[model samples]
Target: ARPRVGYFYTGKTGSEIITEKLMKYKVETFQSMPIVVKEDDSAYDAISAMFLSDVGTLFAVDQDNNLVGVVSRKDLLRASIGNQGLQDIPVHIIMTRMPNVAVCYPDELLVEAANRLIDKQIDSLPVIERSNETGAKVVGRITKTTITKAFVELARNELM
Candidate 1:
């Protein structure tokens, strides 16, 4: 016999409650592909990719595509506003270098990742996986937009 588990008694049907519970699902369920740049790449190139991708952040990767750092729009803006040539400045100069970047694992809860984003006061977290060679490999990205979209989808599903 299966162990009895107590669930909060709401007026809604069981299926409704189950669906509602799934809204707080794991990060892997909703993470999007990351926009990546190499550490040696130019600041101008990274900014261009950000504009094209419509994202506020970009993950800096090594030649092997292992996560090495994180760069934000603000970083690029700072670099550009200082009268420095963006095309010549490398992204690694302004990136939040590895061992300092906050990251999330693919298997963690989405809500937990959201909390980390808020607590860290950042716009996104690179979803990473342990690699035998590299310390960590960026697999995906979870952003505020991703969370909002997931919430909107769940609300729409609940309404239907």
Candidate 2:
């Protein structure tokens, strides 16, 4: 016997369907590899890493690979355009330090992370994982692009 296909929809609005899909989706499912830089690294190196990785943000990690700060392309550009010796400056000087950064854990919902990105006016969130030895280690990164990709995928799935 064949199964039914179109019985699920009763009176759901488009917004409702999208919201339900987002709520069920986890951030970890869509997060991508994070580009990391050392806090003491030169700003030039940090910018180079960003360009090489084709990412707009970079997580500054400690020796233990624990997240310490976040640096954005805007941060680097702002620092670079004004000073002649900007390249010599360290990333820690320009990065948004820990405790000030908005982060999301891997187990959290992607919608929550998306809200954080919108509310905080940021482009990315460092996906952290609590560790006994390293405190909060950056396991991955979720960006606006990631969120958009997820939404597109959800829309495609719904259409199909």
Candidate 3:
């Protein structure tokens, strides 16, 4: 028997509602333009590129413009403090090489990308397209900030 004395029915729990909304988002809708550097570029150059772009993560690409590795501000910082000059150390030396790097696609669910970021303990994921025969071409990036923006926007929409 249904309780009708004082209870009112709600369609879904708050968490359930949020999850359903979040699940509907795809990475393409929230991704930001990728910041990339050549694999052979110096660590110093990578740092400069990151600083100039105001991005913490930089995708390292080969001559073919295929994503070869991923580097972070921390990696550049570590290399900068080493005995060797930052200018002398190639980005490939300090980057997390491909296959070892976590990546997502534009069509991937935003929730899955968020989970990937959490599970990998990474700051961002390079959005890649595998249709190319050369290799995976980095298309965009999904960062914690991007995910936060998505959540905030969703909340704002709900409030309105």
Candidate 4:
């Protein structure tokens, strides 16, 4: 706001404003529908699903829709090129299983999720709802591309 003949200070720098907005972002705000494959599905099937859905990662799920593992494009490429048949090898065999997979929740801060993605050196993370008895349910996915888009949007926003 402007005064009759002077300007006022909000006490926040442009970088601070960007940080404030970025920190307020939640996983649910930018997460997209997740692509998934059954734990029993073959590596061949996973490759097909990944290509068909245009996703870099695929969540591995059980019959109850509980997250069992995560599969990356690199995992498939490495497993698929082996002499052994991909169709005969289950995705679970090539996936990063529970206790090793990185995940986020709908209410989690987007920055936290992005940090996990970078720290874990992964392209994507499953957004899940956890239940001690039922296991984590894969509800969405957050990718590096999505985080970059969010930052780009913030930079383009009217902040001055």
**What TM-score, over all chains together, does every model reach?**
0.82, 0.86, 0.89, 0.89
Model 4 spans > 4 angstroms off: 1-8, 130-133, 158-160
CA lDDT of each candidate? 0.88, 0.88, 0.90, 0.90
Per-residue lDDT of candidate 2, residues 104-140 (tens digit):
9899998899999999999999999855774678889
Tens digit of per-residue lDDT, candidate 4, span 1-160: 4455566777798889878877788899889999999999999999999989999999999998889999999999999789999999999999999989999999999999999999999999999975566688888999999888887887787322
Clashes of each: 0, 0, 0, 0
Question: Tens digit of lDDT per residue, candidate 3, span 22-87?
Answer: 778888888999999999999989888988999999999999999999999889888878899998
In candidate 1, how many Å is residue 124 off?
Answer: 1.0
| Candidate 2 wrong stretches, greater than 4 Å | 1-15, 131-134, 158-160
lDDT of 1 by residue, 1-160 (tens): 4435775444688798866786558888879999999999999999999999999999999988888999998899999998779999999999999899999988888878888989999999999985577467888999999878877987787422
Which runs in model 1 stand beyond 4 Å of their true positions?
1-24, 158-160
Q: What overall lDDT, based on C-alpha atoms, would model 4 receive against the true structure?
A: 0.90
Instruction: For model 2, state the Cα shift of residue 72 in Å.
Output: 0.3
Clashing pairs in 3: none
- What 10-residue stretch in candidate 4 is worst by lDDT? 1-10
lDDT (0-100) at residue 90 of candidate 2?
93
Error of 1 at 54 (Å): 1.7
